[model samples]
Target: MEAPSFLDFIIHVTGLPGYLVFSWFMILVIISLALIVRSSLKLMPEGIQNVAESVVYGIYSFVEDILGKEETPKHFPLLATLAIVIFFYNIVELIPGFIPPTSNLNTTLSMALIVFLYYQFLGFKRHGIKYIKHFMGPVWWLVPLILPIEIIGHFARIVSLSVRLFGNIFGDDLLLAVVFFLAPWLVPLPVMALVLLAASIQAFIFFLLSTLYIADAINEAH
Candidate 1:
C-alpha cells in the first residue's frame, strides 16, 4: 500500500462534523437521570439516593446564595440540570475516544441560546411591562444610547457563552489529540490530568455564569 500524503491524512481526520456521539451521550444522560430519580424514591435513602440528595442540596445552596431563599426553590431545577448536564458533557472529553458534546459549536450555541431565552423570559415574567425599562438606563434622556448598548450586551452574552465553551473544549480536544498522537503512552497521562482539571473548571464557570444571569434577571432593577 502506498503511504498517505499529509494533506490526505488531514482531510481524512478533519472531514466529519462529529456530532453523532454527542447525541448518543445526551440520550445516555437522560436515561441515567431518569434511573437515578427512580432509584432515589426508595423508602430509605441509600447509594444513588444519598448521592442525589447531596448533589441536590449542594445545588440548592448554591442557588440560594445567588438568588436568595424566595427564588431558590423556583430556579433550582433548571440551574441544577444545567450544572449537571454541562459538567457531564465537559467531563466526557476526558474519556479516551469520547468527544465532549460541548466541543461542538452547535451544541454550545444551543445551550447558550437556551440560557439567553430563559433569562429573558424570567425577566419579563418577573417584571412584566417594566422589564423594558432595564434597557433604558437611569434616566429617560439616555434611553437611545443605553437601549442599544443593553440590547447588544444581552445578545453578546449568548455569543460569549457559546464561543467561550466551544473554544475551550475544542482547543483541549485538539491538544489532547496531538499529545496522544505524539506520546501515546506516558506523557498523555499528565496531559489527561490537565484536561480533567480544565474540563471541571469550564463546567463550573458555565454553571456560575448561568446562576449569575438567572439571578440578574430575577432581581435586577428594571
Candidate 2:
C-alpha cells in the first residue's frame, strides 16, 4: 500500500491540497506557543510554567544585552517567540522519525521574511519619514551611492538568516541520518549529542542576529 500524503488527506476532507508539512509545524508552533504563554502567566509557576519562565527570562536577558532594557520589552515578543519555537523544532529534530520544520527552506525563509518585515516596520514606525534617511549617508552627495548598498544589505539579511538556519539544521539532520543508517549504535551517540548542541547554538545564533537587526532598525542615531 502506498503511504498517504498530507495533500491527499486534506483534499479528501476539505478539498484543499496546498497544505504542507510547514503548515503542520506552524499549527503546532502556534498551539504550543499559546499554551506556554498561558502557563507562564499563571498565578503560581510550576512545571511547564517554570520552564517557560526560565526560557523567557533567558531570551529577555539576551535581548536586553543587544537592545537594552527599554528596547527589550518592545521587541521581546518576536525575539522570544523565535527562540522558543526554533529551539522546540530543533529538539524535535533529534527524535527518531522526526525532522525540524526549520530544516526546510520554506519554513526558514518564511521566518526570515517575518523578521525582515517586522524590523523594517518598526524602523519606519519609530523614525517616521526619517527611516529612509538612514540609507542616505551623512553627506548629501553620498545618498545616491549609499542607498542601493543599504537596500541590498537589508535584503541580504533575509537570505543570510534563512540559509544559515536551513543549512545548519539540514546538515545535522542529513549527517544523523547517514550515521544511523550505517552504524545505528555507539558511533551515532556522540553525533546525536553534537547535533543537540548544534540545535541550541543555531537557535541562539538566529535570535542574536535577529535582535541585532531589530536594534539597528530602531536605533536613534541610525
Cα lDDT of model 1 by residue, 80-172, tens digit: 887778777877766666667889899889889989999999999999988888888999999999999999999999999999988998998
Clash totals in order = 0, 0
Using TM-score as the measure, the top candidate is: 1
Write one digit per residue (lDDT tens) for candidate 2, span 114-197: 999999999999999889987887788988899999899999999999999999999988887787788888645688889999
- Residue 116 C-alpha lDDT in model 2: 97
Assess each prediction's global lDDT (C-alpha) against the native: 0.80, 0.80
Against the true structure, what is each candidate's TM-score?
0.84, 0.83
Error of 2 at 37 (Å): 8.4
Model 1 vs truth, CA RMSD = 5.6
